[model samples]
Target chain A: MMTTKNGSWKIRYILLLIALPVLALLFSLCVGRYVVSVPDVFRSILSRFNENIEVSKLAYITIWNVRLPRILLAFVVGSALSCAGLLFQSIFRNPLATPDTLGVAGGSSFGAVLSILLGFSLIPLQLVSFGFGCLAVFLTILAAKGKNQSMSTIILSGIIMGSLFSALVSLVKFTADQEQQLPSITYWLMGSLQSATYSSLLIGLIPIAVSIIILFLLRWRLNLLMLSEEESCSSGVNMPRLRMVAILCATVATASSISMCGQVGWVGLIVPHMCRMVFGNDHRHLIPACVSFGGTFLIIVDTLARSISAAELPISILTAIIGAPFFIFLMRRKGGWNL
Target chain B: MKLEIKNASFAYKNGRTLYENVNFSVESGEMISILGPNGAGKTTLLRATMGLLNWKSGGSLLDGDNIADMPASKLWSKIAYVPQAHNRGGSYTVLQSVLLGMTNQIGLFSTPKEKDIRFAEETLDRLHILHLKDRLCNEISGGELQMTMIARSLVSHAGILILDEPESNLDFKNQMIVLDTLTKLSSEGIGVLFNTHYPEHALRRSTKAILIDNGKVQFGATPSIITEKNIESAFGVKAYIGQFETEHNMIANVIPVGLTKDEEKTEANEEDSDVLATLSIICSKFEESERINAILHEFNDILFGRMGMPHRKRNLYLISVNLDGSKERIKMLAHQLSVLPDVSCKVTYAKEEES
Candidate 1:
């Protein structure tokens, strides 16, 4: 049952959602391992435009170079993964779909493992990882559409293709040297944002940003993708084209984010579901909600990952530790999920 | 608007051909019903006619253009389809769900405009579901959700409406609500085509009916196609279409009593010889009178004398038509007139075809 909601509560709700990511970004910048005071952080950020306001060189370097790019990358990867998750779930009409639903994570991890074994540098490894991620989706589509086209067959093929890539990754891991390559492979597979340079951000930004923007532009039609096949087709949309474009975009976003940062896992599965719990299932609200809350959730998690201990913790560990319980609590209170 | 399927045939891969060379035309202001047993390809015909599925050899045409050749957006903007309610967990609010109907009208990067939303609201209001605008679609009853889906289709401003089992999961009253809405929409000059499992519903409401039994398809005027013998053969049951005389008019119904245990062909359609009769009609509204005129025009060759008198004070039109034709076509014309809203027609024979 729904109460007769006035427009005032809706306005307040939208404002609160929009504010979360902005506030999280600010809070993340000020309270890190090298703690810049809040006012000093704002002053230093503003000092670049006005040089008359004196700022210490160390604080300047730490705020602008170290924390800014890292947290910014955190926002990018976070939103990208969650948007991908939301898109896949709508496309498959299944609540359990994730950014890795089409095997992008498995395929990209195998590519990264192979790259490390072959002693390839960072850029080539990222490219190889993205290329394989796309290849996995392509193969899944081909297999699913081989004889007769159906949604259930596609889901089955994705599961098969995903496990195949995971097995291949394990084979590569079994072949890597224990002392040098294995530990690095294992660590990277656990996921990290420590290598979030400005260049890495630039590379990862294109696919994620472009796809997210395109998806936002075609936001309402995303609702149609969740409809049954006949219902969707009759809505006067070019459903095949819409479906192709959406799936391609979600794939690129998920693949590029995995290539940029290793495998920050729980944010993709949890953030979109959290948004649905709060905002309901209208894509007009769900898309923007996923973008904002996803970015905010990851910024907070990554901030804690870097600051909680002397050595950096894997971002995925923090995400599960924080996200799982919160997700469970929200589910219980909200009384379960629907799409 | 006219949607025509010409020589279209369909079959699943490595399976029996469902039907061959099926052809029918549905024009604007006409209500057509499709009745078939399970697995008779009732739904598949609708899908292929809309080009959602490809036919084996032939295809459908909208006006003069082939449906398969037109762009999806162009074709769908002119033909709205409401599939059967699936009791899905989709939680989009009723307003938002209906607003998605304007997807093809809005641009690639645009949300629906204020004008589009107003149209959606007006459509829901027309369907009497305006109060449920902010309610979630899944949270409503099956009938409400069915109406919501129909409203979504109507908001597209399509000239032709197709529905697949729009009344299947509903109670008697809910079925009447849906069927009456469709009938009213059809009278408003939008071509309405729907698949129904209830033969009585088809015979009672449709201007034309298509029956697909096993792999054979038959299409004709509603009364002629949904005869008692046809129902018996199609459904494998001993059934009869009985006329129940009410105070206002003669309403026809189908009663299925028992299943057939033996395969015996019943040649019971031999009583359609020439006869002379007069059909008296009372139309409560101008629209119903106009519909009556259209139906009478089709039998003008057999009709001889016609008279119309309008009582302005009472808001009713009293008319009588003399027809000299086969018993089948005359009864069909009377049945067509009787099915319309606020229209009652009775046939009185001058020369009866004796038993």
Candidate 2:
């Protein structure tokens, strides 16, 4: 009886499977002036996969090299931010909490921008940016760790650390030579994957991949964290240790994304809540949903940023414009302010 | 298994001592209620038992093993806790929230199996609230929310259930439901330690009671041991203990003097000389003995000289006095009145109700 009842409920999973491709295709096609037909895109992908008749080199390059990289980067970055956000929200057990809200992104932005203007091109500027990102997060964690491990204390530390790095970033921006360094630093701060090289993608890839893998593995622990500390403790979780590990994983993922992409906002803060609103807050459903949705959502957003103007707009500006209104809508729909 | 606390003391970081030097024990299958006032640390004691707090001093044990030394995961299998429902204001569905109870068993990639789902469903069914299985947690009524939390605790299947104010947010109907469930869980050999402000709930749900006040264990015993003195000590107020027969069992109501409005106002009115003058004048119309008996009847069972009244046994007597200075004196007065031969006395005295 149990088996039949449980087995009969396979339609939801099947629907998710069915919807995934349709969403992916729609996301892929929505970007760029050269509107490639779905069939043509599919044929191109299929021929490339099957090693069939030689396809147009321009179509392959445009689809595979230009559009696909940008789309995949958006997806990967979005997934990283949202996953990190979900992890932070559950760990802190607060909806207002997110991975970037802790100033990890701001710190990384300072590091990346500093490396950019200072002309420290050695060791791949991405490494320098990621290093500074890790440093800022480490300092914030240290500040928050002094007292009893309370959620409020950690949030306060994040705010303090975020402000400090932000001040430093402003300082660096103020003194920079206007001709050479200003535009580059501004572009970096505004945040675009336009400069997304296969090399740069590889640099961002390690941390995002590692962080997502860790989050997926600790999904059960993340769910447990939503319970009261007492309940979590009694449930056999080495809660403090698990919490530290989760927070570290989230920090690394967020910091790495920030270093590579340069301050992509709201995806970390808003996407998880959106994911939870649609899929229930079970981490099993929540984690995967956030990853896929975040990736798709960001891909669409970046596509819009690139295609809407004669010149490509910075992705961060577009994200804030779209994301802020959507976030407010989510907040209203959730009716969280009433509480 | 036995849960033991050997001189446990708890204080917040601000040096606000909640409970200090408290010692108590609970055997397997026993249901105990820890009763206290708002700031008296009933919740803190529960937190200590669950090893959720860094105790200022002293120790807690689960079946002779020191809880502080035990890892949280290992300790969890032995004890499951349901905190007050109000704290869980997250945007989680009832089923999803309850399924979180299987955190120890389920892995990240792994889906919930038929057994886990069945266990969760059964727990909800046992609480008779299976209809709310798919509802968002925030959308549910507070009573149903409390029931869902209980169901979540049940799914953990721990040897012990520690509930901190499980009845606080619940209405009377849900409170009764929880008491019934706790009683059943206890009967099934799960030791239950619940903190409650309601004396009646303690009497209904618990085989034993631990009265906490002033950051200490004031009294720990069976419901029978929860006398007027104990109530007064735990919450500095005199209570009117009324034992009444019910369809299923005997019901004991410990209505404190200042807590019940109708009772407290009448006590205040009795002291008025103007009312006394009017009563004196009316009494003069009847014979002295008949007037005395009539005057006694006019006053609700809270006053003196009640010999026979419907629902009141012929052995009834009433003791009314103003409580001065402290609860200890009022308790002494009530004790003296109760000991009077062939009389079931009611003591009514003015005292502040400790919220």
Candidate 3:
């Protein structure tokens, strides 16, 4: 009954959501330390599918082994955090909500720190980190439960849990050996995609992908969650169930991401805000927008993280440096946003 | 569908009882207005009725099923509730916001389909808000947002609608649009129950009125429920309930005079008896004459004789009827006729007997 008022504009934006991430992925592949030319990267990728093309080993090794896994890792972590951030914002009905709102990152980082201090293997470290992340959110809910289930109370509990985990991480750091274990623990806490091997990626990608896909499937009902409490309940949708599902998914996504790549903070808050500014709050538009833009943003940031110096800089610093100014500019231009 | 509250009682969590032994039923084609003073549990009553808040003892029944035990999707598909116009989902456009009412019918994984969108647009168009379909709800005016909310509720095509002060804070024109829309919807066989701050709106539009006053809930025909004594008792204000003559009808208007500090109450008149009267009517339009005839037909049992004539050149109609009914019925019939447009009516009562 209603025609799309700006049909071309809508299509152009959709194209951008898809195209930006692909471009970022390509950029990440072509701009690393031992760089391959754009055509060589394309040709090397094509050679695997087509036998007629000649393959270059340097291009193949650089693209497939080192940069490709890292790039995919950026996309996975970025998309997962962004979707989780958006879901948390909707569930709390507050724009300030993010992936770490429940302290999953802090708890999981503590898990990694404990693993590193105890001299665990890479696989056990990731598993321990993921387990602690889930535990953090469970503790947050337990703390906030039966207090009328108001959102602010849960958020306050999340903050308390987050601080508690951070304190534990600090306690571990104070007692850790300063020679070897301390540096690795500190490096992991700063967040980097340098250790993104295929096996690690495979272990982390399961929870992130499953949660993101489930969040995407339930995108339409998310708008209902943004409504006031009584309004949402009377909408005939099972709001508490929806809220629990969203919180659980976001928890899994955030925990898996933190376990894999330390604490990638700004992407969760910034990317979802950018997507909301561009696409408004219809989760139908916001979910896909958050995934694509979130992935692309981290891909771009991670590319810059590795290339800006002889030594890789911490990801959190660059993300804040790059994301804060951009977010402030967008917020100022739009005046502000509402839930 | 009929929504019935039977022996429903409600109390706050602090053990303060809001209301007790409340009973009312609204069916298709009926408009029921809920009136009460501030903090008199008007909102609580509505929330409890919709099962948003639990009733302290008794529960609401939709048709036959217990509402408290019903699943949300099953319950909402039959009843639509429009809350205060200021809602939290302002980031959505008008069309999308209205389409939210279709969430129950929509599948868990799917977006709104073409048919659902069409229905949403049609409901907006029916409310004359199709022009603002793509506009964000926050970018629109308060009245426009209220209308959008109403459009959302209507899009569900529910058998019953409940609104919380749908016309409050709206401009005069928006008020008319909202009140008129409710009237038209009820005429088309949708039960409408709304909370209102205006007793006059209840008198003008609703067939049934409920007043929650002094911890008591009263329900009856609109005219009887909104009398002067009831208004004073409910709102703690001495107000005059008088009729104003408009071109089409006599409209009941409530004018509050001053606040009452004393606990004294006015007693309702006990005078009740049959009366003999002759009613005279005049109309300039044929439609007016027909409306008069329809009103007069309701009191057909009291009529002993009737005569009518049409003056062709002057295009006027004159009718006279001799009536024998209770004093209230005759006054009510005359009051009803005097309210219609292009008609003038008067009733003259017969003298008392010497016995």
Listed per model, the TM-scores of chain A against the true chain A are 0.94, 0.90, 0.95
Per-model DockQ against the true two-chain complex? 0.55, 0.26, 0.59
User: Please, what are the lDDT tens digits per residue for candidate 1 over residues B69-95?
Assistant: 898888989999998889463787888
- Expressed as tens digits, the lDDT of each residue in A81-142 for candidate 2 is 88998888888887778777677877888887788778876236678777777888788888
Docking quality level of the chain pair in candidate 3: medium
lDDT of 3 by residue, B1-355 (tens): 9999999889889999888999999999789999999989888888888998899888899998899888788899889898887774646888888888788888999888778988888889888889999988778888888888888878776899999999999999989888888887886789999999999888877878999998999998777788888998889899998767654445678999988777666776787778789987888776457767887888898898999999878899999899998876776677556534357776778996676
User: Once model 1 is optimally superposed onto the true structure by TM-score, how far is the C-alpha of residue A140 displaced, in angstroms?
Assistant: 2.4
Question: How does each model score on lDDT?
Answer: 0.87, 0.71, 0.86
Q: Report the C-alpha lDDT of model 2 over B147-255, residue by residue, as the tens digit.
A: 8887877777788888888878677787777777777677678888998888877754565678875655854544444666566656777786765654322355778
In candidate 3, which residue pairs clash? B248-B340, B248-B341, B249-B339, B250-B339
Q: Which of the two candidates, 2 or 3, achieves a greater lDDT against the reference?
A: 3
Angstrom error at residue A6, model 3: 7.2
Ranking by TM-score: 1, 3, 2
Q: Which regions of candidate 3 deviate over 4 angstroms?
A: A1-13, A49-56, B268-270, B276-323, B330-355
Q: Give the Å shift of residue B96 in candidate 2.
A: 2.4
lDDT of 1 at A260: 82
Tell me the tens digit of each residue's lDDT in model 3 across A1-339. 122436887788789888999999888899967788989998989988998988788889888898999999999999999999988888887778989898888889999999999999888999999999999999999999994878898999999999999999999999999999889999999999998999999999999889988988988888898777766665788887889999999999999998988998789888888887767788888888988999998999999999989899999999999988998898899887666
Q: Which one is best on TM-score?
A: 1
Predicted structure 2, TM vs. truth: 0.80
